[model samples]
Target: MNIVYSSSDSYAPIAGVSIMSLLHNNTDADEINIYMIDNNISDENKKRFENMVDKFGRNIVFIPRPDLNKMSGVDIEVGRWNISTFFRLFLCTILPDNLDRCIYLDCDTVVRHSLREFWETDLEDKIVAAVDDCRSDRYKTELNLPCDSTYTNNGVLLIDLKSWREMNVEKDFLDFIIAHNGNITYVDQGVLNGVLAKKNLVKVIHTKYDAMTVFFDFNFKDLMKVRRPEHHLSEEEYIEAVTDPYIIHYTSCFLSGTRPWNENNNHPFVGDYLKYKSMSPWKDFPQYPDVRKKSKKMMTSVCNAMPKRMMIAGISLVHSKLYPMVRSLKGKRRG
Candidate 1:
């Protein structure tokens, strides 16, 4: 199996933990070829990654990050995400031609099961397969996609390089970016969904493959109420995903600066991340202070400590009553 990750020096330790987890969990697989889209990672970090992979009897290929300025016709403003995020876009251009398929995992993930099943999943003539984004319909509207279209999270992708090459996907992606330069909200993710979802080219995979933090943190009923209608995970599937997730995408927590490695984070999966970190080469890595302010942490703690029923009721009232009234008042103010 071919696994790809993109990271820079700043995120190398976190990326190392993710890679270690992948290697640790998928020992049953016959072979695992790891590839990293390098963003000038320091030699020390590279050695650390090498040691971690070597310990697992696996090897990694470091593909140099492509110059986006040279690759794209228009300048891409990579917001909160690093330039390495754009590296996935140019996999076909950067990787060797003989490599036909690869599984792309974001650095903010930890694998919890053998990926043989996921790695062997058939793309069914699609260029890529991914989990449906939690906010699928919102993304659809943001990108002006059809209501029935699937908006996928690019975090976990099973990519078919042959299809990408044959269909000139690279050119299409560049063209899309140039055409919709300033309109993109989620950087490369938005561009990917905008281009591919419109063509009906993305295969929607099981959520377990990219089980996000929101899957565990949010009430399932509340989640369903807010989710797009096109996200068609059955209750059974949803339960299976939450109960037996293969990959934990610490996406929301990571973005909110409440990642497990942060001192103030109390995310449920922080223990899981710490477990992997203890086993990794960076076992002694220190947790940094939380990026979230102390006041926010206190507020979050108070809210989290609320009784489940009360919490749900409060959220429901806010969504069903307060939010609509606030919108109405804003409209009246405009009038």
Candidate 2:
């Protein structure tokens, strides 16, 4: 199994917890090789990863961060998301040429099951396979994609590196980013979908492969009530994903915007994260302050004050109607 992740110094420990969970859960696999794209990670953290992977009898290779400045329009500011999020865009360029395929997992995810089947499955000539997430008709329209095209979460990707290199996807990614005038809402996410999904180059997969936090917090009915997605998984599949999720992606909650690693977060998977933390090389590591300031505290209190159902309804109304109307304005919707 080949796995890739990107992280900076501030997020390296959190990424370590996710890696520990992956190694701990996939012991049955014959071999697992991890490739971490370095982003100013401290030497201490690097050693932690090396020692951890050694103890697990796995391989860990640290790839030096590539220069994004070399790419046109890469200097554009991306909201909240860091430059590391764009690292995967150069995978075919930066990784070993011999590697034909790899699974790219975001640093925020925890693996709960083996990925043998998912890794070995064929892509059927597609460049990548990922779970369909963040569905919205406006997303396609914003990118000028065809009506039937699908949008997927770039968080967990099974990439055909060989095909990507053949098609020069790295160049295509740069062109898309530049064409958008260097302004992308979700940074690398918008670029991936804009270039790949528009051409029908992505294979949509089950949510079990990347079960986001939204799944844990809401059932299909309530999710529709809150998110108002244009497309989504069926009720049966949603339940299965939540009940036996293979990869738990601890995305921020809409109600409170909290994550499992935060102190006051109400994420149901906090226990899972804690268990993996205890098992990692950072087991003795102390928790850092969650770094909330007074303004954020006040907002959290305000959001918490609302009734759950009322908040869901309000969010539903905004997502299904008001938000779409707002996005319809030129330059408002992200590609």
Model 1: per-residue Cα lDDT over 1-335, one tens digit each: 98999999888989988998899899998888999989999989999999889888898988888988666756777766786777888799888899999999999899999999988888886789999876635446656688788888889999998888988888888877776652355678877898888899999999999988767776577566544344567777778888888998987531233777778666666788999999997889899766666776775666568786675566555544464456445434533
C-alpha lDDT (0 to 100) for residue 28 of candidate 1: 97
Q: Pick the candidate with the highest lDDT.
A: 2
Model 1 sits at a Cα RMSD from the real structure of: 4.7
lDDT per residue (tens digit) for residues 1-335 in model 2: 99999999889989999999999989989999999999989999999999999999999999999887676645655667788898898998779999999999999999988998899878896889999875556666766777578888888999999999999988988998877767765678888998999888999888999998877777688887777666778888888888888898887655556687776677776788889999997878787655666776665566568887887777677766666556446455443
Q: What is the C-alpha local distance difference test score of each model? A: 0.79, 0.83
The TM-scores, one per candidate, come to 0.86, 0.93
- Runs in model 1 deviating more than 4 A are 228-230, 253-257, 293-335
Cα-based lDDT at residue 4, candidate 1: 94
What TM-score quantifies how close candidate 1 is to the native fold? 0.86
